[model samples]
Target: MESKSSPCRPQDLGKFEVTQRDGAARLGKFFTKHGVLNTPALLPVVNPNILTVEPRSLWDEFGFRALITNSYVIWKNEILRERATKEGIHELLDFPGVIMTDSGTFQSYVYGDVEVSVEEIVKFQATIGVDIGTMLDVFGRPDMTRKEIEDAVRITAERATKSLQVADTKIMLNGPIQGGLHQDLRAKSAKMMAESEYQQSNFSIHPIGGIVPLMESQRYHDLSEIILSSSSELPANRPMHIFGCGHPMLFPMCIALGADLFDSAAYALFAKDGRLLSEEGTYRIESMVEWPTQSSHISPYTPAQVRAMSKPERTSLLARHNLEVTQRELARCREAVRNGSIWGMAERRSHSSPHLREAFLGIIRERTDPNEPSAKRIRSIIRSTDPIRPSSEPLSEDLLHRPHIIHANSLLVQRWRPPGSWHDGSIGAPSRVVVMKGGEPPWRASYGSTVQRVLKEDPRTVVMIDSLIGLVPYSLEDLSPWCRVEGSNIHPIGTKDADYSVDLESMGLGGIPVLVLTPEGSEYEQDKSILAWIDRCSFVDKLSVLCAVSPAIGCEITDEIRVRRSNTNRPVNVYNGEMHLFSPRLNDGGISLALHGAKLIHEAMKSARDNDEGSTITTTK
Candidate 1:
């Protein structure tokens, strides 16, 4: 008997997998029929009604792999509707990358009401062959009452059922969460959309909608709350889109909050308004003497020359420049995430505007609020910290419950390995805890002799580094935040006498004698007697800090670890226990382990287990 082909499925269409993470920031790849989208990515909103910069240029020039256009806008224009339907959206736009289509939700918000029906828009997008199609959900406005917003959410959900049924197996649908400014309503909407029966089969992305007004008003605090409220209820596997957000200024914070996608028409709109987009903020092109950023489109022409061009020519030039700036910032964000410094990037960007800074603080406060259920969810997502601030920076209220710092401290208490037991078969905690402080790196050069001497004299001592974030064992010295984080050297005011007794207790090191080594300067002069004492210690009593692992460590630990920093400095491959690793001292001041070294450590641990040397390490965060 002839068997029928398997029906089309969402997995067959594309898939999203997180390759690396820093706090809520995820470096992921979303596979699509067209190509792979490296997220968190921005999709420039292209209007078919106008062609400021060709869609093809967005791909070839700017390197945007995905874009979004309004389906309803095409549907309203007979000529565009006919061309789109007959030739397909890709052909119509002359773009070869992934294309997403929006139903008239935003249009409805702007024009009071759209003529298209929910099912009608969904089916139309499918007919045009969009990679992702949005539903015709009701746009909830911030000014709406609770009951009104509730009705909007309910109506959107109701529309979703029929829209999904119509969109089945044809295209990926966007299940947007909308509830205006009400947190509870937003949560309710998110939960419903995330758990909907159709979501399992058809939904490709979850976009938080109805917050454009807030962004326009610069009410970033409320915007932050809305995002947190909606994201807490979203499915972790699926990407979350921050609808109508294109400005580079918002990318760092939004990406830090787990938003995987952003769509904005700002590049063109701002260009039309003579506004130039920048990471700091938008500036009027007419008022600028020099180009804020060098771009092929605007760099050749002086600001005065650009201002003298015809309006259409000027708009096109500025639009290209704006897109270039947006792309650059996105690249910067991706690099930050790779370096485990997204939080730091967010902090730096927040200083661009008072409202943005307030929004960032608001997000921190809300996430740290014990009473908020969403806060708990946020805390769970933070996996690592890239030392949110340097020891020299003043600790603000926002630093207390910073998600990355919290995650780091938690891991320190939980995953960190403690020294092995004594020869008497009795568990022996370290006699004293040594905290290394003062300048960065050359730890081996500065304190190597000191550490060796202390260990040689008393093998039971535990060495820990007091980083800007928290205390981490010597074994994790090369790990993120501790090694790669950059910040001030000054400690926060009023924290000099702060009590860390509870922190000590959490790591099971409470009641132990503590010794702190503060270097007088960048260099530490070694004492020969101390080194000679270290040489006398037994090998079993001294802990071994293993050398580099394999290249897999570079892949797994730091996402896309780069060796080349500049023309002057190039990385040299070195071996750590028969494993190849790249030393990136010149590029970035950090050590990367290779896969073989990692396996060597694993095998050693396994051998210990077989020989019954000691019990496996266990921890509680």
Candidate 2:
């Protein structure tokens, strides 16, 4: 099942809201009764029975805001059980931040089964006042038969009623999605578990359960399959915990797929086994002449010195190192979300391992939008990306797939309409296209005069700029993006002709007779009539795309056009006669409507409504 971040809502215990996003990956807050916790975060798995790193240090020194422990473990221990119930789990663990209790489900996966039942553990976790709790789910093993996996999923869902019934409302509960290796069953489990069976409440968070063995084997491709298949089915409002997925290498892709919370014992376990974690891959201390990835915990000591230490000392050093690596990588993922560069980070991180690369590419090849339902909303990165970034990046092979670029191109196809006379020429379309190559922005210097001449002569001729981004009409050129590109590294237009052609068709541009023409090096021709025509065309196009007004009506609404240009000779504010109609913001290449323009658009829309009893249309042709 999928989980997403939302920033618009006020959060409380059992409430999750996404504050920011890049693709499906969200930088969000999960409000626990204990406190508000930020994500894409890692919850260091703490064993109540064993303290490799103290829980308080995990919060203070390691900088983790949340940690998970097994309720079953504490429940089995008579002394610890009595202490936890009396003192509360926070007092028992000596931690002040959020504490999440796990059901014996994972222990069930490890040992044959846990002695505790679902009802007892739920009541126990609630009575102990833990902030978050999990139901004992049947861990669907990769080796399980189809019927067995289905039954396991059913058993887990069936337990939700009792689980939520027994759980205290003050604590959030994890509804685990299970299907072993089968993608379909995973989706089914996700949908069934999205809504809590208990009245007046819903599951606070969802964990993708029963895939630890896949992570153990580095079966990342299958792990990605489960995430991609199940994510869309999960509720976008809750955090999706990738249960037991703790390795740093998997964090980038998993977070990118909308897995919000993760808990893993690998940091401690790997340390004891003399292995160190990195975003790339694990390293064995015995083989390391130098630390491939250094941390404060291990940088001062040589591998030989570390190996020479006492067993307990060595374990502590390595565990701290592994913990720091995990913390840094998770922070890196959050920063990527903030910068709208998570896909790029994931791209770079994918090269860390062959399996990771396969998983990244596999998702790329997935034509379906895995971040569905969420992506369909107005705040989805696809609709809300900034038109101009502060700095430009060298384009990658997956440039078209980037969220901002995808958003830009999608808006064009969905909103842009060629002018009425675009097909008014002799060829049943425009006579000449004049496909100007946009090398860098401030487009006026090279193409402005040529565009003016082309439109002056034919009036109906199509003028388009072939940019690093796909097809863009002259009206929208220098608007954004292209203005902010790094010319030195960006691929020249027409180099990726096939990809360009697909996007061009997506824009539904008509077949023009003649294309690509260079600028004529001549003195500027100041023709007033042609200049006004150009202004009208620009106004109509921007209005249609930015405000979703009909170009024909926009032309009707405006009889006068005056453009305010920036120092770069790019249009900033556009006026209709004496009144400001629209402004293409220089700070970002998005259009803002003037009050008068909004009134005009409103009038057009209200007039267009056909449901009113007295509404009628008048023909002008």
TM-scores of all predicted structures = 0.76, 0.87
lDDT of 1 by residue, 1-621 (tens): 111112224464557789988777898887776767789899999999998889988988888888999999999999999999999999999888889988999998999899988789999999998888999999999999989999999998887778888898788789999998888888889988887756457477999999899889988778778878898788778899999988999999889888899999999999998888989998897778997767777878899898999999999989999999999999999988886667768888889999999988776666557766456556655644443332322344455456666655665566434544422223556788776666465345445655655665666777666666666665454444455444424541223544445756777778988777654444435554443222211111111212322222222322222233345322344444344534423333234445754564466555656876534332110
Can you give the lDDT of residue 592 in candidate 2?
81
lDDT minimum window of 10 residues, candidate 1: 536-545
Q: How close is candidate 1 to the true structure, as a TM-score?
A: 0.76
The global C-alpha lDDT for each of the candidates, from Candidate 1 onward, is 0.72, 0.76
Weakest ten-residue segment in model 2 by summed lDDT: 1-10
Indicate which candidate wins on TM-score.
2
